[model samples]
Target: MSEPIPTGCEGVDELLGGGFERGVVTQLYGPPAAGKTNLALSAAVETAARGDSALFIDTEGISVDRLEQLASARTEDVEDLASRIIVSDVLDFDEQGEAVQDAEEFAEQVELIVLDSATGFYRIRRTEDEEAGDALRTVAQQVTHLLSLARKHDLAVVITNQVFTDPDSDRARPLGGHTLTHWSGVVLRLERFRGGNRRATLEKHQAKPAGETIQFKITGEGLQSVEDVP
Candidate 1:
């Protein structure tokens, strides 16, 4: 088995028994302000730092300032590290799906593939109940493509997602549901907690039992794990 990609976040890595697994799709889902994107960026840095290029499909714009802050610990030349990540800015859901589907053309060149917020445009176009199911089907199909692409190339795939909340019960869950979750071998959910800390829950995994969690804060440098978090 290939070694897991160590996300610089200390505690969370320990929780996963090393880091994110390669040759499979891992889903990171969370509500707004839960730091799902922060964790995704951290993975890109870790994966790209391994001496190979990475592909970052940016549905939401990435912050170079944040990259500089996060990459500073690993290399003096943040620009060099940043350069290793080939970013594709996708404006709409159709464009997003195309970017993910077409990634196979360059699969051999990258070690890590990240789609930050796979559901950004998905939610926008599917706001009404009638269109949500079709949107979900499209997302699920695209994720399956990513799953096959990851295994075919032995790449570590990370896709961030937003949650859908039901007004009746005030319950929130990952938007794509079982259809999307099935494709990911590992699923981690981020939840906002008190005092600027985020809780990362291991919802599904191959080795580690589910429901184990860790708390961390987004620092100037990157994510810092907390102790005795509430």
Candidate 2:
């Protein structure tokens, strides 16, 4: 079997049956300040430590400073790791679609691809456009194209998404509707936990059982497992 991509958290890796598997889309959805981006960055740090490249398609203006800080804790040659990460910043729906589609070309070269807050652009478009179905469909198509790239190149695809509370259950739901939930192979839901830690729940997965949760915290070094906590 191929080696699974680590998220830099042993507890999370165990919950995920040895981290994320390649050739599938992994959705990390949560509310604001849930450390979703931190998890993605931690994964990138692990990839860089392995001497591999990863692509970051940023829709929410990701912080390279934070990335450098995290990477520095893992390796002394932070510049070498930072150089391997290629970031593409997209400001609008059209540009976001283009950036996602562009991942196909770099699929073979990079071991991981992250679209931090992929639904942010779509959410904005929906609010502004009166007839939003057409725009949403276009974005959906772009996501499908990226999934194809993941399978074709056997790369780990990590996509972050926003969440809204369901009125009925009072639980958080990923805002992309069925268009996202149905397409993702693994869906991990994150929420704030006690003691400044974050809880990651296995909402959906192919191999792992659902409803399992793990604790992690965003430390100066990156996402440190709860076991490492003092």
Candidate 3:
């Protein structure tokens, strides 16, 4: 069996009972500046640092500067590690679907698939049809496809998402709704923490109880546990 993959964060790995399972899908959601992209990039960095490949199908452009900064501390040759990490950017939902389909080509070499912001275009292209019938269906189909790829290839999958404000509760929730929550094996909600840090709450998990919380800081060295920094 493939080994469970570490997310490059000690606290998150602890929450997952070591790390992410090969066939599981992890969903990360949070407000702006909550470190979603940093987490996603860190996953890629972790994979590439291990001399494995990662396919990042991005709906938004990745931050190259941040990626370099994260990789430098882990490996002597940041360029080599970055080379093993391939990035495929999609402009909208149609392109996003196509990108996932094309990802199969790299299955043999890739250990992880990070789909950053799974619902970017869905949010933008959503019709006045409040139910978003057709759009929601697309999200379901694509997510299922990604999960199937993970299981068949024995690779991990991580998908980030934007948040939507719940009018009734005045809370921010993951954008893809039940479609995302149903398929993901683990779901983490990131929020601002005290002292320039972030908190990750295990909102859902297949094998673990929910509501576990951990606080960490993001820096050039990557995500660091700040448990003692009260």
Candidate 4:
């Protein structure tokens, strides 16, 4: 059998059946202000706190200062955790591929690699009038390359994605659609719930059967497990 994946949060780890399985790509999708970045940051902090190095590739200009503030405000050993975290930004496919390769090489010494706002990496290639097919193809190639890196290196890959509203369809969907959904081993959707709380629902997973949804809260410390909303 394959090794179990580790979710950075204890509560989440239990829910995920030990942890996210190693050597698989997990996608975290949410709309703007849905606490997606917070989840990623929390995971990175947790990984580093466990003495495992983590690399974060930022495509949306995720503020390093904000990460520092969050780390200092929440973690017990902020300085030590911060020391284990690394950040990179990729502006195009070429740069992104190089970053993924570098990250894979780095993963030999680390436990996790996070692509913060993975979808935004494709924005560099988008034109105002670009066709949907072309955009999908571009994103597919990038996801494929990243997944290969993750598997080859035996490291967990977590990618954050932006959600898009479907005007005609009632169901909410991710921006990259099937290309991303198919490539990923797990797909999670995050959203704000009542009382300003947020929920992380399992939209899809291949390892084991998962329920429709799960709930979590965002505190100044980061995401914490909450009772699932009925």
Candidate 5:
């Protein structure tokens, strides 16, 4: 049997069959202010609190101050948790490649690695004139390499993605397309409720079946589980 994975959120862990699967990529996708970053940060904090190290790769210029704020706002103790979490930012694919290598080397001591908004790297690497197809291929290569590294080091991988409206259809979709969905073992979608509350819905899972959606609320103390509203 595969080793157990722990979800940062309590209720989410129960919904995700004990937790996310180890040595696999899990994608968290949502629109702006949809609590994607909040969820990722929560998971990272939980991993660290459990005596495991976690690495956060910030590509969208998520400032150190912002990270500190999130860390401090964690449901768990911040000072204790911050020591176990490391943060890095890369400007392009080349930088990302190097960062991945460094993360692999560090994974010997770290338990989890998170790429906060991986799509940002793709956007930075893509030239204005480049076709979507070419850019996607480049992103695919990088993600594949990272996945390999995660597997080799037995590190759990978490990636956050931005959502976009699919003009051709009514539903929302992740920015990177099929390459992302195919590579990730789990895909979660987050949105805001009528009262500005957050909702975390499991959209897809390759490792196991995710039968129902769950509700979550964010506060100064951090993410808290809520009953699923009908």
Candidate 6:
């Protein structure tokens, strides 16, 4: 078995039994400003800091400025840190799929792969219920392909997803439907808390019981795990 990749956030690492497991797909689903991107960047920084390269696929226009800031905080040489991170800006669903599928060329170089807002383009094109469902189906298939690559190459795949609130229950659910849920090996739901803190709930894990939560904060340095979080 491959060793887990540490995410740099102590609390999250502990919750995940060190960090994200290799050869599986991990999904971080939540609402806007829930610190999903922060966590993703934190993982990338940790991966790069360990002398391993990371592939970051940006779908929702993730801020490069913010990434640079985080990278600066994590390492002394921001340029070297940036060099290890291969970023691909994907504008549409087709491009997103292509980027993910074509990542094999970098498989030996990249140990961790991140897709920020994997469902962003699908959500944007979803005008009607039928269209939304169809888009989701397509996206799910693409995600499965990505996961297969992860398993084949022993890469850790991390995907950030957007969520929608159910009108009847007022409960937030990941946008990609049950198919997406089933594809992911680990599922975490991020939420905002008081005092600029964030909460991450481990909703599904292949080896562990669900409903475990962890606390962390996005700081000037990066995502830090809060000790004895209340």
**Regions more than 4 Å wrong, model 2:** 227-230
Per residue, candidate 5 scores C-alpha lDDT tens digits across 84-133 of: 88888787766776776677667777777888877875654454656767
The pairs that clash in candidate 2 are none
Per-model CA lDDT versus the true structure: 0.85, 0.85, 0.86, 0.73, 0.75, 0.86
Model 3 TM-score, all chains together: 0.94
Clash pairs, model 6 backbone: none
Global Cα lDDT for candidate 5: 0.75
Clash totals for all candidate models: 0, 0, 0, 3, 0, 0
Would you give me the overall lDDT of model 4? 0.73
Model 3's lDDT to the true fold?
A: 0.86
How does candidate 1 fare on TM-score? 0.94
For each of the candidates, the C-alpha root-mean-square deviation to the true structure, in angstroms, is 1.6, 2.0, 1.7, 2.6, 2.6, 1.5
- Tell me the lDDT of model 3 at 120: 81
Taking all chains together, each candidate's TM-score versus the true structure is 0.94, 0.94, 0.94, 0.86, 0.87, 0.95
**Pairs with steric clashes in candidate 3:** none
lDDT of 6: 0.86
* True-structure lDDT of candidate 1: 0.85
Backbone clashes in candidate 5 total: 0
lDDT of 3 at 103: 82
> Across residues 1-230, which tens digit of lDDT does each residue of candidate 1 receive?
67877887989898877887888889999998899878888878877676678788999988878877888877888888888888888988889989998889879988788888788888887775558888888888888888888898888889998888878778888887787788889999999998878999999999999999999999888889999543
Q: Following a full C-alpha superposition, what root-mean-square deviation does model 3 have from the true structure?
A: 1.7
